[model samples]
Target chain A: MSDDKLERTERALDFSGIQAPEELLRMKRATPARIGIGHVGARYKTAAALRFGADHAAANDAAFSEVPEDIPARLGFFSVQTLCRDKAEMITRPDLGRYFDEEQKARILSSCRYAPDVQIYCGDGLCAPSIAANIPDLYPAIRDELVFRGISVGTPFFVRYCRVNTARVIGPLLNAEVVCVLIGERPGLLTSESMSAYIAYRPHPDMQENAYTVVSNISRFGTPPVEAAAYIASLIGEILEKKKSGLSLKQNEE
Target chain B: MKDVLMSAGIDIGTTTTQVIFSRLTIAEKGGFGAAPGYAVTRRDVFYRGRVHFTPLLPDDSIDKEEVARILSEEFESAGLRPDDMDTGAVIITGETLKRANAKEVAESIAALSGRFVVTTAGPHLESVLAGKGSGAAELSTRTGKLVANVDIGGGTSNLCFFDDGAVLDTACLDLGGRGIRIENHKIAQIFPGTKRILEAESIRLSVGDSADLPSVRERIENLADVMARLLAEALLLLPESPTLRKVVTNRLITCDRIPEIVTLSGGVADLLGNLPEDPFRYGDIGAFLGASIARNGAIRERLNRNTKETLRATVIGAGNESLTLSGGTVFYQEIAFPLRDLPVVTLPMDGANPEAYGEAIGRAWERIREDGETTAAFASEGLSAPTYEEICRLADAAAKAARQKDPSGSQTWVFVFATDMGKAFGQAFRRRMPPKTSILAMDSVRCGDEDRIDCGDPIGRGDVIPVVVKTLLFDNGERETI
Candidate 1:
């Protein structure tokens, strides 16, 4: 026998690498190494919402309580929320949260009156932590900007998966020229707290993407949310003046 | 009084369907409220023809009836009956329509809805994205040439060119994450136990699992490389001058979303780890050989200035998409909503969060939906639902074929050859087995149809056939050969 054959014969049959059962190899080739995009991690889109806080946790109760009349939580445009934190349970489980839960809906319906020129809202997008952290600081700036422009702002309402399409729903709801939505951006590895604005002209369910503008990377460490809010308000200004949102208006400007 | 509304937007996408409820709101006096200067618009509900996010099958068919049923259910669930919607916009993707039944399925959905569904197909996803909104106008202003926006999705990549914010050309390629998973069939096998658990949790249906992990991963990587080249080649076909900037994706897909600021939305450019300090400074002479594209002087300057704070490009692009409009018509008024083709870049999973993955997937899918017309070469017709048992059977048959063809163990012996060749052989061997059977590389293998069979032993000079066949087998499993 040739030296190669002798060596080959002496070598033990390496069976350790057999991953699947021997029966599965009959018509099989080598295992394919498909290196493409992977769903390495996933949060179920249809699961029940988890509530982390205690006492205030709405998950613990299925009923609504009346708000004290004396309390100054009275309806104001600034009091609007684009997303109710309780609605966040609808993130992965949209079915559970797609529609407003009863009490929460009542809270919004009673507190928010309709027919402003533009309804500005902030939602607990993909990152609740960021929404909670930034809204307190950013709301005032945005409100002031809209008020300064003489843009009639209405009580804000939030939605789940508050996409640009959400603006379309808001358009008819507010009977406004536009809807400016400040919601949590889908969080990335770079940062979790970033927020984006979706501003649609003649907002409606059919609103196009260009009708919305985004100002993202809203971490306090980056562009302060307050500053970002100011810039967004200005963009809304341009949208109103030009009556256009995307490349078309930009070109006419140039 | 019950209100009636009718409108549909068919997002014939690479992975899933996004049906928008066009018009269904009560212009109620106190509903949106008093002294209301705002418009109250509502769509009672929209229907989604949620299909399996896979590539088209050889048979070129889809479950039309099932899709229609699901859509009808959605409409009913939304408190609207099928007859309520009078006008609809059926958005067709070029890739999903390729295998033949795309029109049939789309028509079926339209027929069921009982509305005026105008079915249209653009070459790339960017058209859909542009239609949604993106600064197609400004880019055209800067560069006199019509601008093309490419969107990379989970199951396809869509490219679109706009002149003064109007679409000129489009295309789509089925080279997305879902497509990769289906073709490679690795994820299904590697974590069978995990998959069962996940399915039990109702995360994803167990229709396409049953392949090996390594083989699937190998096929996925090879396809990724091929997809990048195909994308570059597609861009070369366009007449627009190459923008000097070369954008880099997360896994170093250099040409994913570079070249222009399609919109001023900040997040679109922020997530890709930041643009190169002088992106326009360097050019791959060999790569952009035919296209005489000069880099945007202003954009290059902007990148240099804000290199420190340009992540979340997709989010900002999504924002920009929201801020723009195409075709001069108000969004709600137009029957066919224009799709925006935002430049999208994707990064590999370097231990990123699920939200990031979802975002990447969402962005890529957006591109596929927007620019499906232009990237026709890369489109898949539709993801036909297949059972796990069928996939397993296919993988088993492929493995058996490999074993029979190279029975001497001589073919298997090649596993001990030089490192690269040996690795390739081993990879091929694995792909021949299990869930790896699902992937189909465009030009990977030569089968019995060509009368090309491997010789009993290795030839001294190395025949190209074996290597190619080996690669083909590795990329796809045994049963996947044409």
Candidate 2:
């Protein structure tokens, strides 16, 4: 990121003596891939190889970084952690990442509003940096839209070292009509700030994966965070009206 | 869910008339409910009618009844009724659009053929269509090269430049094949433009001139060579000749740069396929003109050896390439199908400044009212992934400005947005509009100044509007830069 000129140059096909320079430049505008790097003696150029290495390191940092508890507290949401202690266990022991003790459960019910029309929260699923990058704009877009529609939403919070399955426990425990989880997606070469939203209607302990409706690949570079928020808002309205989500919702659409 | 729509293209040109029907597949992307952003994913031309000479009465007016009969017969042969078609275009091109009854005749014919739309008639639009139909656009898109095509029809030669499949600039000239007609080797009829050119060249041959005079034949060949040189100059293959300005019709081409490939189309190009021995075989100067153009080294050097189409480029373009789909989530409560020729007014968006945005909307509304339009499409290049507050602010400003002008909400309001924020803005505008107001908001569509929007019936799995942005006539006085 430090070399601004190199960042723009590597993404474009700027090889010398191109017959159709304008057309090749147009193709460059359409994609984010590393292209147009002319090789010397059948090997990668030094700058291009270095840029690839730099991008790989950034993805790793996004995966291993932790979102501080103070960040969620500033947004007026209480935070809790799962059974996993660190990033190693969160990645290796995904089964442990889905659990919470009785003491933490007591703290959740006490701090959260009960039986609201909809409940939404965030989790550091795989990329913690994505949470701070998108939530400030994303959260209000969804909340204000639902408010305008005269739909009620419950208390929001954060869960550390979380998995997608955690929404199942929160759904039945709070007795909410619908539950939505905004979490970070696994980092890819193109972007480390992408996030996802998983939603369901009336969750239970034994619910399957197909029970949740999901929208993913959300970031400033992918689907705009605010645009994704607007879509999630309307989706919540449809789920409440139809009383369904995931496979059932798709079937009903047919 | 996948839906297929049947479409027909009817071209009423200066020298010939034709009809073509195509099946357009509308695939629901993302999912069925997600088809608000929809397009014709695939197009297959199922029926192509044989070319027929355009029938003209003694008074030089198009024979309306004969035209109608040709259309009916073509549809019957294709096993399709007019009602079977979901969307299509009827384009009256070249000199035919200048006839007194052109608009009325075109409208009636369009109505006779399903929910068809007629273009107002513009050379730029025609140039783009011909470029597309002739495969020049596709060639540039596929090979990543700059391509240009000259559609040499009966009364006009349209030059369009394509860079990576998008139109860059267009120009038209009063050059064509049917300038002089022949019968039994004798001159039968001469159009006014050809008469003027002949008089300037000092060639005294008139109608009913001797069929086998060597002097007259030599003069005609000289005229053909002169025209071929002009065509070469138009593509910058040669130096700009002295007569270049006099032959240009509406506007001059501003491509400025040389294209990698150039293609020829229309009837003259069709005639060049095998270099007919008889110059007057088709009762016109087309064959002789084609031969002369083929001999011109400047054009031959850059010509595309593979011509995808010759005589049917514009007609195929009209039929298959005219339909565009509206995208993003949309909101339209009670709009009727096939809304044709809604004049567009583009409102200026002052980026995050609500007060400036409101003033801009108010001024644009006044312009629409001044133009005496009962309904118009308001277009904007919308913000990227707009936040909720930004959407609300803009929507609120627009609603308030509109309320002051048309308090009773008698005029229908249609917002043509440029991004997927259509439904979001639609919902916000819906909440604040007057109770009697009806609105339509659609996005992922682009339109230019002076263009008209024609929205066909909602089709397929999603509420996707088959939209047509028709630019019939335009004067690019100050040419646009890339």
Candidate 3:
């Protein structure tokens, strides 16, 4: 119910007797935050209150639900889980989410292709619904662009209860020159379908947090998935040419 | 500062010719790790030549060689050649533009002027630029209020009402200081508008009339009073008198809201509040006309006394303010620059459906097929924050229309949008389009059917497309293509 609601929600100016409704509609369309919503005397109007409740309800569902296994199965993405055992533990034990157990690590090393120029994969981060919504469009665009640009790419896969730093572990195991993780961001009041792309050049366990460069706020309400995919593909090309990402790349540009 | 280029402005008016050279600085304006947008950051006027009387032939047409010679001398004085200017404008304004040979003369001057002055002004453009250079546009922007400027020059009064720095409406009147020219205390010349006014008012004024006669002085003052009252009526947005309606050029003053302030520009503007002792000091009735405008009752209350500019408003605007930089993140392959005078076609977006794109693009391609023109620019006021599905639909609609129009796929296509979806749309077209089509899709530039656009070379690391949205229609009954 929440996933269907997230796809179909439409907003318009909630004002009555307005002289220029188009102007307010333009303003409302320009931003993701709540705007042009009607209010009662000292309170939100009943319809607006109910809509906000629906959105909050949707956000909570995104925070707790699991991405159906068929999503990764349809894309032929091999799946693995981090050290965290369940969603409850994943909520409180973020450090555990960044690493894999021995069996999961062995499975990744045995199943994935070896030492490609770039390795990309998906993760069910705090907002799992975003993975369901954006990946079908986003993943293929990145793959096609990289293939067209003649960059070698490794076999794609998925991770459950994953954090961003999981890309650091995967990069060293495959000996990839660049690693990218397309992960779902935490749900906000405005949207639960937002996603992010985090890229690292030759990432390792010793790398600092600043070693990763990030592109965030990807969704229909933000930079749409296909556009973000194109931008990320070009960014990866830049990283490969410079042989760096994040802080060192910024310094070299300066 | 990746781009610091010299720009020259040359304004040929009915009474005077002015020259100005300015240096424009282009810099990056977008946020870090984002599409790098660029804009002109600063403009410094390096030289301003002394105003000279516009040399005219005996037949009342501008002398092309004389204008070019003056510009050459001024360029030498400024220690620059005519070809040194990178970009600027040559604006032929006022009654001077009505001459039969005006377009030929302007083209000649522009040919000798600079590398690419890619801008031209009709009367409407004149009013917009004068408002900007006179500080009325800035005042309205800063205060977020309504402001108006009246540029009363030798042969015409150009009016622009600005709301928050955008032109709300524009109007021009056929009255100025030089309508009745005085030479050596005798009436030298009278334009047709003034002749009509004199006949209607039953005033006996003619060429070679004595300027020293008291009755003639009284009649001239009465004419000045009538001109002032007509201007006052237009400013107040009152129902126009027949005289006022007869003088309105192009479009009438469209006033939906009252202006909080009014400013002045052009040559005769400085004469107000400092009326000359000799009303014919400038060999014209300019002083009396200025005095009558200053004392007009209907618009006096909204007048701004400290206008930033008077004489050089139009020239300064043409030189330092006419250029616009395109938004970053455009998609183009190998292309040429300085594409000038292409008539525009617009594709307006319907709510949530991109079906309107096909009809609009079909109309444009039909024009192309008829004219045998190889290139045309298609513009859109695109959807803000559009979804990926919406953009793909738009792109598919556009590409299908292009394929239907030219199955050969050998023509160059240009797409300009008012929203930041150029790259996405461009990529979508790339996926669906044939390999032979040359495409240039850009965002954050606007044009209508009445406008022509010029694209200069990409600057700021090829992240910017310098654009000049110009008009080719002269107020006189013919077209001037540059």
Q: Top model by DockQ, which number?
A: 2
State the fnat of candidate 1 relative to the true structure. Answer: 0.00
lDDT for residue B46 in candidate 2, whole number 0-100: 88
lDDT digits (tens) for residues A1-254 of candidate 3: 12223333344247696666755554554455566676778887777787789888988888888888888898789899999888888889999999998999899989988999999999989899998788877777777667767899899999999999998799999899999999999998778988889999999999998888887877766665766776678778889999999888767754
Model 2, stretches more than 4 Å misplaced?
A: A1-27, A40-43, B28-39, B199-203, B273-275, B408-410, B434-436, B476-482
Model 1 interface CAPRI class: incorrect
Scored by lDDT, model 3 comes in at: 0.79
Question: Compared with the true structure, what per-residue lDDT tens digits does model 1 show for residues B1-482?
Answer: 22233445445554444444544332322221011111224433323323333334446455566566556665666677666654454544434544467767766665664433334333322343432333444455444444544454443444555554545555444333233223233232212222332333333423353334445334333333333444454444322222211211111122443334332211122222223332212211111111111133332322222221121222222212211101100001011112112122222221113234324333444454474422111111111111222222332443454344334323211111111111112222343433322211111221221111111111111111111111112112221121
What global local distance difference test value does model 1 have?
0.38
Q: Candidate 1 residues A106-178, lDDT tens each?
A: 5655666677766777655555555555665566556655675587777764443334454565567557776
lDDT of 3 by residue, B1-482 (tens): 34797888889887889999999998776343344578788888889998999999998888888988898899999999877877888888888878777778777876774355644477788888888878899888766668989888888888889976888988788888888999999999998777777777677889998989999988898998888887776776445677776777666677767777888888778888546778788888888888887887666778887788788888888887778888766766556666666667787776367777877888878876697666678988876556556767887888898888767677677888887666667766766678757777888898876577877777765656878787656456455554
Model 2 TM: 0.92
What does each candidate score in C-alpha RMSD?
Answer: 31.7, 3.6, 5.1
Instruction: Give DockQ per model, in order.
Output: 0.01, 0.35, 0.18
Give candidate 3's error at residue A38 in angstroms. 15
The 10-residue segment with the lowest total lDDT in model 2 chain B: B473-482
Off by over 4 Å in 1: A1-254, B1-6, B24-60, B120-148, B153-155, B168-171, B183-219, B229-259, B262-482
- lDDT of each candidate versus the true structure: 0.38, 0.80, 0.79
